[model samples]
Target: MEFPDDLKYSREHEWVLVEGKVATVGISAFAESQLGDVVFVELPGTGDSVTKDEAMGVVESVKAVSDVYSPISGTVLEVNDDLPDNTELVNDDPYGDGWMVKIEMSDPSELEDLMDAEEYQAFIAEAES
Candidate 1:
């Protein structure tokens, strides 16, 4: 329900914050709520290459095990190392410390395909209907 206006979102529920060529990625607040209490996270290592739409990691919650997808193709520059041990951060602050990865993007143009906050709000509205 809390969608940040500055971030781009995927219909699959990932959020992206682009700063120059680097994109910090995370699941949206709505996504964390749907998944319930997160128990574990499996993330890609630094220096890993990820393709757009590809599975980059896994997040296991009390309700389900979900794949975290890359919103853009890039090389992993950083990952939230604390997430595997402290999963509650994903729920408590999805837009900040809950960020899953930071990647050096392969194509900035790919960002155009993702939805802005307003569009994503409409997207989820239609989805829940």
Candidate 2:
């Protein structure tokens, strides 16, 4: 499992990539692996307000249906329209094209609550044990 150092991770297994005030959100590779094959994705509409640590969307896999949480408070700027039509991308490129949404942050401070790649690696390691 490779946790890219450029991203921040939530304990719920969501990853965040922030540029300016916009954040791109997605499930980490580890989360996708645990979910098995992704069959469906339900994303919040553009302009929807999302609270930190709350369920903003869902990913359904062959194993289970899981909530995809928002790591920061924000208004959704965009959703990956390709997901509903091509769910396999979530498994094939979790860090790239598999990204779910872009959020215009309401509070950048909320990022402080998330873990960096190194910390997230340790977190999942502890979880697996």
Candidate 3:
């Protein structure tokens, strides 16, 4: 329910924040709420190459196991290691500390295909209906 105005989102409920060629990825607040208390996270290592729409990691929560998808094609520059040990961060601050990975984008143009915040909100609304 708390969608940030600046971030782009995927139909799969992933959020992306692009800075220069780097893109930071995470599950949206909507995603975390649906999954319920996250218990563990399995993430790709730094330097891993991820393709758009591909599974890059898995997040296990009290309710379900969800795959974290890559929003754009890129090489992972960094991963948040703290999540596997302290999964609450994903619920408490999904846009900040809960961020899963940062990637050096392979194609910046791919960003244009993702939804803006308003569009993503509308998407969730329609999906929920």
Candidate 4:
């Protein structure tokens, strides 16, 4: 239920942390909680191109498998190499070590379409209601 103020969120439940032109992406804490305990992760490779609003990876939990979508178009600069072997990180530290990818954004303006922490909280509240 913790939505970090420094991050932007996508409706698909992804969170983004922008630094320079690179964006670090991860599922929000809400997404991880909803997915339950993560058991496996499939991440895009470094140098891979990811499109805005498209799935870039998958996270499988004890409950179900879910696609991890990208919130922006870009070339993947790095992927969290530990995720494949330590999927539990997704549940243990979703906003930190549980991060999925870091992309070099192809269109920075696309960030305008995402929500801030307050907006995302409202979005989640609306969905729940």
Candidate 5:
């Protein structure tokens, strides 16, 4: 239920923290809670080109599997390998250590299209109800 104001969100429940042309991505705290205990994280490789709104990877929780979507078009620059071995980090620190990938956004303007914290929270509320 915690959605930080500084980040952008995808409808798919992914959040992006932009820093210059690079952005860090992770699922929202709401998403992790819904997924239950995360067991496996299928990460995309470095240098992989990703399109906006497309699935970049997947997170498999004890309850179900969920696709991780890219909030911005970019080339994946880094992945948190530790996540695959210790998926609970996602639940423990979704905004920091739980970050799934770092991407060099191909078009920064696309960031303007993503939802802000308030909008995303509203989206979550609507989805839940």
Candidate 6:
């Protein structure tokens, strides 16, 4: 329900924040709500290689477990080291400190395949209805 205008979105419900060669990735607010309270996170370590749209990790919540997908092909530079102990951040600040991974992109142009906030909002609306 809260889609920030500056970020790009994947149809799979991931949000991407890019700065030069690095991309920060996370699930959208809508996704956290859908998943209920998050209980655990399984993430790839730094230096792991992940492809765009691939299941890179998992988030387990009260409602259901879900895969966290990469929005771009990249090697992970960092993971939110705070996440395994602070699952609440995923719901508290999904767009900020709650970010999952920082990736050094293998192809920055792949970002163009994603949707902007406005487009993502419309996409969510249609998916929900």
TM-score of each: 0.98, 0.99, 0.98, 0.98, 0.97, 0.98
lDDT of 1 by residue, 27-97 (tens): 99999999999999999999999999999999999879999999999899999998888999999999998
Query: How does candidate 1 fare on TM-score?
Result: 0.98
Question: How much is the lDDT of residue 99 in candidate 3?
Answer: 97
Checking candidate 3 for backbone clashes, the offending pairs are none
Error of 1 at 79 (Å): 0.6
Q: Residue 15's C-alpha lDDT in candidate 1?
A: 99
lDDT of 5 by residue, 49-121 (tens): 9999898899999879999988899999998989999999999999989999999999999998889999999
Tens digits of per-residue lDDT for model 4, 6-46? 99999999999999999999999999999999999999999
Rank candidates by lDDT, best first. Answer: 2, 4, 1, 3, 6, 5
Residue-level lDDT tens digits of model 2 in 2-107: 8999999999999999999999999999999999999999999999999999999999998799999999998999999999999999999999999999999999
Distance from true position, residue 74, model 2, in Å? 0.8
lDDT (C-alpha) at residue 60 in model 3: 91
Superior by lDDT: candidate 5 or candidate 6: 6
Off by over 4 Å in 4: none
Clashing pairs in 1: none
Off by over 4 Å in 5: none
Candidate 3 per-residue lDDT, tens place, 58-122, comes to 99998799999999998999999899999999999999999999999999999998999999999
Error of 6 at 113 (Å): 0.9
lDDT agreement with native, every candidate: 0.95, 0.96, 0.94, 0.96, 0.92, 0.94
Worst 10 residues of 5 by lDDT: 1-10
Candidate 6 Cα outliers beyond 4 Å, as residue runs: none
